[model samples]
Target: MNGSKISFLAFGELVVRQLTDFSNNAFAALILLIQDARTPMAVSSGGDDIMQSHES
Candidate 1:
């Protein structure tokens, strides 16, 4: 019984650790996605300006 309890606790700890890591990675990816989204908008606007200048 004691051995089974110890194993169960270890499994729970591993699950918690994995969940923490997953959440951290997910947060980092979200931040990166937001930055990427902002960058494309800025770049597109800048590109349009360049195109207009060339046309004129």
Candidate 2:
């Protein structure tokens, strides 16, 4: 593969890894809050659960 092609693939891989890390961290935090008897709150950009909160 060309150098440019390899660079693009590496960039894409980094993006995917970052996203996976973020998701794992978010879920871990939620679990910790639940175990501590705190509210499992999450602030997402957009999702069905975000719109269907009891506060609304």
Candidate 3:
């Protein structure tokens, strides 16, 4: 690998609305709201579950 020929990418979508609305929501407030929401909540660790990970 040649250092001079190397470049890198950080590709992803920017959530513009979320970014702008961020100022109105404090960290604690966001946490409390997420906790209170009536949806099934689970934290993802690294890759998705086993089936999806292997399929990809």
Candidate 4:
């Protein structure tokens, strides 16, 4: 019982960290998209990076 509880807590913490990172990346990408709407090149690069991160 004690081992399972510890493992569950560890798993939950890992999930929360991953979610936080993903949300932060998404927010940054959104801001970049808005700020660079006029510049297709910049937007494309940031968007590509976001896609790569998503795959990872």
Please name the candidate that would achieve the greatest lDDT relative to the true structure: 1
Candidate 2 weakest lDDT stretch, 10 residues: 39-48
Deviation from native of the Cα of residue 48 in model 3, angstroms: 33
Greater-TM-score candidate between 2 and 3? 2
| Candidates by TM-score, descending order | 1, 4, 2, 3
Instruction: Give lDDT per model, in order.
Output: 0.88, 0.77, 0.52, 0.88
Considering TM-score, which of the candidate structures 2 and 4 is the better prediction for this target? 4
The lDDT, on a scale of 0 to 1, for candidate 4 is 0.88
Task: Give the Å shift of residue 1 in candidate 3.
Answer: 53
Runs off by more than 4 Å, candidate 2: 38-56
Question: What are the TM-scores, per candidate, against the unseen true structure?
Answer: 0.69, 0.59, 0.23, 0.66
Q: After superposing candidate 3 on the true structure, give the runs of residues whose Cα lies further than 4 Å from its correct spot.
A: 1-25, 38-56
Give the clashing residue pairs of candidate 3, or none.
none
Candidate 1 per-residue lDDT, tens place, 10-55, comes to 9999999999999999999999889878776465678778778989
Candidate whose TM-score is highest: 1
- Pitting candidate 2 against candidate 3, the one with the higher lDDT is 2
Clashing pairs in 4: none
Q: Stretches of candidate 1 above 4 Å error?
A: 41-56
lDDT of 2 at 23: 100
lDDT of each residue in 1-56, candidate 4, tens digit only: 99999999999999999999999999999988888886654667778788789899
lDDT of 3 by residue, 6-47 (tens): 432211123555665675577768886687564333334333
Cα lDDT tens digits for candidate 2, 1-56 = 69999999999999999999999999999887776554333433444477667559
